[model samples]
Target: MSLSAAITGMGVVICGPKEIPDATGNTLSAISMAAQEAGIDLREIDGLLINQNELIADDHLTLDLSRRGAFGTLKVLYELESKGTTMSVLLKQATEIVNAGEADNVVVVFADAAISPNAPSGAAFASMGGDTGYRGLERAGGMLGAVAAYALIAQHYFVERNADIDDLFAVAQAQRSWAVENPLAWIREPLTREKYDAAPLVAAPLRRLDCARPVSGAAAFIVSKPNSSNSLNPVYVRGMAQRHTMRRRHAPHSPWRPVGASEVFTDALKQARTTADAIDNLQIYDAFTIVPLVMMEELGVVGPGEAGSFIAAGNTRHGGSLPVNTGGGQISGFYLQGATPLIEAVTQLRGQGGNRQIADASTSMVVSVGGRLESVNALVMGVQQ
Candidate 1:
């Protein structure tokens, strides 16, 4: 496949809950690290793109702060925002900028300091809508938070597919298996089915292990022309597509159906001029176990309602036919929204995944969904040889 843009560099920063760095600190550090890996001078980075977490203060994370704190001047700068769809969208923007000759190198960074002591993630998530008027109504109806919202989706999926708790357990177990190999993973201990089954329920049908634990950290990647000699490893972007299914219009008819994912994944593959068979690894935004499970089926590589069983059969673990979320995914890894998936893909594509690396993983597919599946995006990438 012809490459449009490729990730040349990447960096990560982990901060403890008490020492949470503001968006600027995280962004500057991560971007500087990425720039060095790309073999480019900091001043040569002409573009800066920031993906601020929904929970962070917008005023605190501005392009002005990023520029003043790091790169003095840039050809392009912008702060991208969304609940979970920011990663792929930011990448697409960076690709467009480079491909159009607007900039030679664009650093995409996601910096978040939302983690707070004794704060419930659900409560913080509820505030992301900017206190929109609908928030009151949603909360009044016992929607509670994202966890509760996803639990409803999980319930619908279970009934439709005849799946039980064991299916969810498999997803969590496989992720933990990978996490044990990831030094950055927050929880790397083996996950027993017994423990998964007995974990305290955060939302009905969704246990504590099912949801991604929020962490304070930053991740950044440098995007540039594919196969640039400046990079030790260049993970090229092959295809990209996005879709937004109006939930109000489709929820009543197909609340449980992942129709949007099917469309987006297919379009992405078409854009890459490749078949699904070429995708050897996946780095999907798995905020919850069922999220990727449903995506596996919706992507059509796995049969409908069979993703749970597919995972249970050990097809997604390391050394399996299609190792998924090789960095343990968001469920086991720290939750950084879309960056969680992209980071793993870049590492594995660069042959830097270490113990969790998939064997000869040349191509990887990435998927990110936003707001209870209201919006979705997919990207196909290949390791530049």
Candidate 2:
């Protein structure tokens, strides 16, 4: 018999605008909570997986984009005083380690503290300049950062699809509406189309609300053998898939090229032996307003260029056909890259989402993106029967 991976515990510490804790503090708190919920002592954890360590030092947010390379493993283990084996693995590999019997109880932690008031300016990061050698070219062309890059896509999308900027406004408004229900959300106020239009434009068609807030927080989850879980709801990892075929590809042609979201979602669903309709909830990555739109098209949830209309029709909100990012997502929720969506999916599947829980949500889908949509990964999780 093959082993299956299931999430038995989860912990999230979000730093709101008024109160922001250090990354190290948030990380420890998150780990302790997850371990407690998993019915295990902190010292009993045998495996550790860390995503990123965006430490909050002197009220400044510093992120080691390499996810701390090898040093991170040593630091986390030392700080936690754990005798467990430690390894840094991506989303898909974490589940594999547990399923392969290499680890019985694996705890994955991700801490980001980018919302501090004294955080470094956006120019301090090289990725903001563009990828490596292209930095100079992008800078010379007046492309400042991520917003500029996605703005280029937005421009092309509008021109090709005859879409309006109002679509972007709708996405921002929808996310805010969802955020209102989430206590951990940073921005919970209602947003109107008029308010969205009044907000300053960061990049041409992309308004300030269109971009996700880089807040400070940490999230951790326990992936263990299904039989080891004692929680009221054990969320099993039904399927997982990732595609990196376009990581090296750049813009202009990149946006028009086929995206990995399609293949990853299909492969994950097939591995789960289910179709998209079975997914009761979706926690799609929301780095920008356009990201989920593109994903919806590729995921077959909506036709190409019709995501705006689909969302406007309330297909993604609570009580809609497919509730998406019911816990505010990265846009209105904390931006921990893909970790935010992963945590949200687990919470919903566990039926512990409070006001954001989808009615009878037994199956959930989560997709994450990295490197400006260069790489995409998808995971299917279900409430274990």
Candidate 3:
């Protein structure tokens, strides 16, 4: 018999300082508290998974006081330590542990502290790979260079398709408008096309406002048996799929690239037997505005390169036909290591997303990327009746 798991609890800690100033501690505390509030005791948790830019010092020291205090007695089924490792890998590990019955309940936590590398402003982008060499270093380069590459892609998208710059500015304006209503968002101020156009460029064709925030925060969730009484009313993980790029990282340029996000999304829809029209909401990762723009095309929501026009039409706004990033997304919402978007998707499915809630939301989709666009993972979540 196959065992199923569902998220029973969740917690968030953003824009604050804490006793455990390190990212790992803050993340653990956030999810622990959420799980406790949802009725899981810290001592009762059998499995723990943590994701951060750096390893927790406590996890290393033989006589570390914090390690003993935090996870000394628990049977840690899985432990991952890497920076810029995709959230999909983390999610996959946790799911396997739960499926194996190695633990009855699992806690997944992700956090990142304020990261300002010693490298020059644009040069620090290379740090995404942590301290590894070669593949890791290349991955880091991809992270840092993403802004530049995305700008190039966005520019090409517009020029080849005859899209006006105003269309892109309009997307920024619409996202900001939604952020204004979200109190937890890092940037809640209303934005204007004039101001957006005037903002200094981070990269040619990409302004500062068009880029996502570099803020630090943490988020967590508790996964347990689907039938557990502690589970939320609905919001079960129904389908998931992950795909990697066929092209190797060494290849500087390849016309036939691997990691097709569109393919993963379509596979997820197939597993869930859902169609674009059946999806009630979406939470595509917006590391940069261009990411979502590409997703819009791949997801078949709109024609290729037409995401700017589609977004400008107001279909993605709160009251629009399809609501996205109700929590302002990484663009406006606090950047919490990419896990927050998953939390938001769960909130919407449970009908508990206050203020930003979409009316009668029954199903939602989540898309996340890792490395220099080498991997894509998509999940289809819905109310479990």
Give the winner by lDDT. Answer: 1
**Model 3, span 178-198: residue lDDT tens:** 778777787888887778878
How many clashes show up per model? 0, 0, 4
**lDDT at residue 233 of model 1 (Cα atoms):** 71
In terms of lDDT, model 1 sits at: 0.81
TM-score of each: 0.93, 0.85, 0.83
Better of 2 and 3 by TM-score: 2
* Residue range 1-385, candidate 1, lDDT tens digits: 6556678889898766666446677767888888888888787788888886666664246667554655646888888776577888888789888989899889888877656665654445555555447756677776665777788889988998888788889999999999999998988999997888788998889999999877777888899875545657787777899887766635455685655788898899998888888899988888888898788888787887898888888899987888899889999988888888988888888888888877787899998888887778898888752
Error of 3 at 27 (Å): 1.4
Report the C-alpha displacement of residue 144, candidate 1, in angstroms.
2.6
Q: What lDDT would each prediction earn against the true structure? A: 0.81, 0.70, 0.66
- Clashing pairs in model 1, backbone N/Cα/C closer than 3 A: none
lDDT of 3: 0.66
Which candidate's TM-score is highest? 1
TM-score of 1: 0.93
